[model samples]
Target: MGIHWKIKSFEALSTHELYDIMKLRSTIFVVEQNCVYLDLDGKDKVALHLYGEFEGKIVAYSRLFKPGISFENASIGRVVVDANYRERKWGHDLMREAIAGIKTHFGESKITIGAQLYLKKFYESHGFVQTSEMYLEDDIPHIEMKRESC
Candidate 1:
């Protein structure tokens, strides 16, 4: 038994599921990364949420947006894995599920992502190639990357 993957619309997530999602996100993106930025950017209302649970804990997650919501192409963002699960390839699993979800749900194959620079190769492995020069988002180096339809 590995990660139990779930993708839900904003209105479908239960209160407890939402809480766990936020807590895991803040733990990694805010506290662990030491970044002080608004976590609730108001986009979750229309985005599709993807989450993974292992041993009853939510350990991996990301959000997907339809075309014209986050970018010209359908996009994936807010990617994170529990600190404890990083060595187990769950990050890769999250992205694979997310990319497929975008295509399956949005009917789009081209996807864009604002990828942290340190993980450029990681995103590249999922077919994203850098499309913009380095820029700082929340004080962390990031680059725009896109994966075109195969």
Candidate 2:
């Protein structure tokens, strides 16, 4: 079966959905990865959230920003997919929809992302190219990448 997609702003999120989103982000970014970085950086209200829910759980998610908010250009961040759903290849699907939403809602032609270094190839497949040397954010290796509007 295919995943279901939901894109909404912080205000539009139901309490339960908001909880699930935070839980998933923490589960993967904090507990799973063992990274204690601050996840809530006062940016949610300005972002458009993208989630792929399956059976009432947020299996995949990302937060998209308009230009000059998170980066000098529009960007996508906090990309995550639940461990249980990894085998289903939902990450790619989630990102494709996120990029589409960026184009549709923001009319943005270019976007930047500070992606985990290991997933560089994955993001490149979607047209994002590395634009900077690798750096550590919260002790995890990351690189800046950008994709121009297609």
What's the TM-score of every candidate structure? 0.98, 0.98
> How well is each residue in 6-72 modelled by candidate 1, as lDDT tens digits?
9999999999999999999999999999999999999999999999999999999999999998899
Candidate 2 per-residue lDDT, tens place, 1-150, comes to 678999999999999999999999999999999999899999999999999988877899999999999898899999999999899989999889989999998999799999999999999999999999999999999999999974
Considering every candidate listed, which one attains the maximal lDDT?
Answer: 1
Off by over 4 Å in 1: none
Distance from true location, Cα of 49 in model 2, Å: 0.7
Overlapping backbone residue pairs in candidate 2 total: 1
Q: Determine which window of 10 residues in candidate 1 has minimal summed lDDT.
A: 141-150
lDDT of 1: 0.95
Please tell me which predicted candidate would have the highest TM-score against the true structure: 1
In candidate 2, residue 37 scores what lDDT? 86
